[model samples]
Target chain A: MSIQIWTFILVGITFAIYLSIAWMSRVRDTRGFYVAGGGVPALANGMATAADWMSAASFISMAGLISFMGYTGCVYLMGWTGGYVLLALLLAPYLRKFGKFTVPDFVGDRYYSDGARVVALVCAIFASLTYVAGQMRGVGIVFSRFLEVDVNTGVIIGMIIVFIYAGLGGMKGITWTQVAQYCVLILAFLIPAVAISIKITGHFIPQIGFGGVISEGANAGRYLLDTLNAISADLGFDQYTQAFGPNSKSMLDVAAITLALMVGTAGLPHVIIRFYTVPSVKAARLSAGYALLFIAILYTTAPSVAVFARYNMIDTLNNVAYEQAPSWFKNWEKTGLIAWVDKNGDGKMEYRAGKAIEGKPKLTGQTGIYGQALVSNKVVDSNANELYVDRDIMVLANPEIADLPAWVIALVAAGGLAAALSTASGLLLVIASSISHDLYYRIINRSASEKQRLLLGRIMIGVAVCAAGYFGINPPGFVAQVVAFAFGLAASSFFPILVLGIFWKRASKEGAITGMVLGIGFTMLYIIQTKFLGVGNWFFGISPEGIGTVGMILNFAATVLVSLVTKAPPQDIQDMVESIRTPRGAGLATDH
Target chain B: MENQDRLKEYWRRNLRLMLVLLAIWAVVSYGFSIVFVQALNKIHLGGFPLGFWFAQQGSIYTFVGLIFVYVWRMRRLDREYDVHE
Candidate 1:
């Protein structure tokens, strides 16, 4: 069957499964709606957390990033999965013990300050919304390519589906839905890796295949890394396996970034909420262990995919004539996802980095441009600017370039959609919960009935869906770029406060408020200045890496200094901290 | 009185264990991969660079191993503390 038809069938099957799961597990009350009656199994909850954690970026962009970046791409793999260890060990169990409905609830009550809760609430919503916008865009991209629809229409459709499910079922529905999503996304990622491994190395396991030297015809035992590094250097890029940037980042910077991500991942409200679904504190802890295991499956395989794709691309096209390029090349070319132009009119695509050559125009009444129709419908200026390097193209173009069957290609399309939708649903539930449970019932209308709260939750979801759709339609910025901002904000604001509130008995309301504000505020000021004001050099030499680290350091310093300046919290708040720390109080709420 | 002694002993022991395991986790991940990668690159494992191994696989294996150990030891500690379900 054609790839399009197969994509339809696979996507159809996935949607049917989600709708069925959502239908069967409808929420009954506010408690059930918010936390699934707090009775989900630990292992199942872990799997769902994995699904929620691995968003569209993980499935679609991460491997693709590694494909071109080679060894340096290890940063994403190590940073992301390593963060989970920090989460499971340090944060999840204590938060579960806190027994709160939302992250803000923990902060507000722990500090005995509504102001602190509002700060956390602002941070959570900002992080969640930025993350959700990226997912919406991811869904739209996959749907546009596979389902043959406009990107915006696909976005609206995805938003509607999430609205119906997340609005109706809340966290209960989201957890089960995420489990299904994890299965589909993992299968989709692994199948291609396995197929390509067998094709290239005569092995099924990608990691083993990666180490096994290339066994294909005419390239037997070729070292992939050596070949890729040579190709990259040929194209005016850094050697693929070697680090190219500044040879020095302070140990402090490294520690700060790692700590920020580690704390940030654990601090993410969407991820923390998953633990609340489990039955007991022990289960909550165990669930985090399981989530890491599931995430590890993808984390380990991703580097192999990156290395293999890089080696294969260089080998397949080296010195080959342009007109005879594979169908996948032409297909991606049409989408403007990948582009190449022949210089010197040599009837061959020269994939190299060199200075521009002035030449005649290809099509013009009067022109003096380096222009020629060098290959089949491919034009080149005598002086091409540079090779196009959009990172999103890597995964979508992987299957076709590797000559995989139409079915695998279709499955990948569905997989990307699954990753996007699953995470979006999880976030939407949080957004719904924040409104229905925290804002409306707790703050705004304390006496509102459960039925009214549920209705309000659904209404809030509709509003959230519309907002997400608008961003997806006109994506404000880069997918990976926007995601980093969310992480930065979270790392700065929520992580420090949460850690202090849980671990330090003396952390007062003033300390929590000051830390969160400085963390988020400093990071925002740096980002705004760097991106808009173009005065990146002016701000403590702050680039993306430096800004997050600086923000985190400032957060720590402010919290400590402010806490020392302010009086220790009241007797009851001090007791609350002690109770949360003790294992005996596991069944009771922190305040009680 | 015996139970109280056992619980205090358990908390003291578990705290020590958690600190040790956390050290190992930090060393393998941040220490090896970020701080000491260049130094460790002089040593190789199975023809693969040691630093690359830690970045890609070794660190993850360490994390998983640490968690399982934590769970197993924590379960034992819970029994000692009379906190086991």
Candidate 2:
């Protein structure tokens, strides 16, 4: 069969698997709808969580970001995984003990206020929309490339698949389906990478290959690190080992970004909801550990892909002329993802560093100074000056660049779709829960029956998926930039409230409300100004990246100061705090 | 009631172990990798910069280690709590 035909069959098989799973696990009660009947095994839940968490960003964009950023890309590698540790240690078990179906449910009950729940609901929606945008786009990209369809058509098809399973099966279906997706996406990611690594480094293991000595260097036994750094510097970029800018800001930026991602990942409603699918507090904790282990498999290998792609890229075009650039180069150039300008009207291209120093005025972003334009204007002489590489194309292009089989390329397409669809489905689940559980069942119709609540949840999932699909078409900006806003909202709102509720006996409802309002309010204002209004240049000296860090500080201060001013949490609430922290009664936590 | 007390105590021990592991987590990612990366990069590990390894490989190994520790300890804790499956 043709590659396209086979790819279609693969997608059909996966979709059928999802639908059948959802069909078999149809909701019999509200409990099954919201928390998957609370019966998922710890290991299965872990795998599902990994699938839900990895998303399009992890599957498609991350390895690409690392490919060019070299060592700097390690920030994402460390930050994302470290955040899971924070989730497992600080958040998951207690939240599980709270025995809620949604993130807003926890916030509402723990703070003993509906207003706090509303704030949490709003934050969850905001973060979910921003995140879902990327996943929808990821779905579109995979469809556009392999399925020979427009992004919008792809999104519609993706939305249908999500609606069929996610809306019908609820948490139960999503949980098991995510496990299947985890297998598909991981095998898809690893097979090509392992093949490429062995071919290039002559080492069978990717991790060891990344560390092994360069085979043909002047220093034949030179370490991979030294060789790569020299190559990066030769290309006019900073050495892979060298630090950028002043020490203080770099430290602050790294800390701020890492903290934002950590707290944000832990606080995200979609991720938090996964914990609810487990049977007990201990199961929640174990699921988190499993999720981290599953995630680590991808995180560890992503760096290897990055290093390998960079080396392969540099070697391919090192001395080749613009006219002789490969077919992939020309194809990518048409997409504006990889551009080569013939500065000075020269027929050839020059890949040297000092060339960019001559022509253009450097752009000063609202934040600190961007490094000198990485691209030089000089036409590369037979040597391509600098490749204008877009970060989004990295993961998609890696397999093709490695000369992997066409079936492998098709599998990568399936993997990317799986990653996108899995996260999108998870986010849609959160959106549904917040509406059906927190808003409808809790406030709007407290007396509603299980069937009504389940119906509402399904309707909400469809609406959320459609809204997200619209935004995916006209993405607000780069995938990372848009997702950072989600991080900021998460850092500011959910993290502070959840932490204080669990750890501090003195924390009050008034304080929790104040913290969430100010935290989310400040973060929203900053993101709106910087990304939408273009007002970042006027007020703060820095960009939107640093706003979450500031907002987190504000959240903490507001929560503390208000708690001191207001009445302490009631004795009962304080007792609840003690119980969640104590971790006793792991199996006996009540639905009440 | 005594089973509840044992379960609570089991939880307390689990929390204690997490705190220690988390401290190591902070030191590796924030302390060595981000805050003092340049200084550590000045030192070498197997010809690779120490900070680079910490950022790319070292922190991940620590994460995996923390997970196994948590799982092993928690299983025993479950047994102590009389909640073992």
lDDT of each: 0.74, 0.77
Query: What is the fnat value (0 to 1) for candidate 2?
Result: 0.52
True contacts kept of 1: 0.35
lDDT of 1 by residue, A400-444 (tens): 766788989998988898899989987877776676666667667
lDDT of candidate 2 vs native?
0.77
- The DockQ value obtained for model 1 is 0.48
Reference-based TM-score, model 2: 0.90
Report the error of model 2 at residue B28, Å: 0.6
User: Top model by DockQ, which number?
Assistant: 2
Could you tell me the interface RMSD of model 1?
A: 2.4
In model 2, which regions exceed 4 Å deviation?
A: A216-221, A245-249, A330-335, A344-349, A352-386, A474-480, A533-543, A582-592, B1-15, B77-85
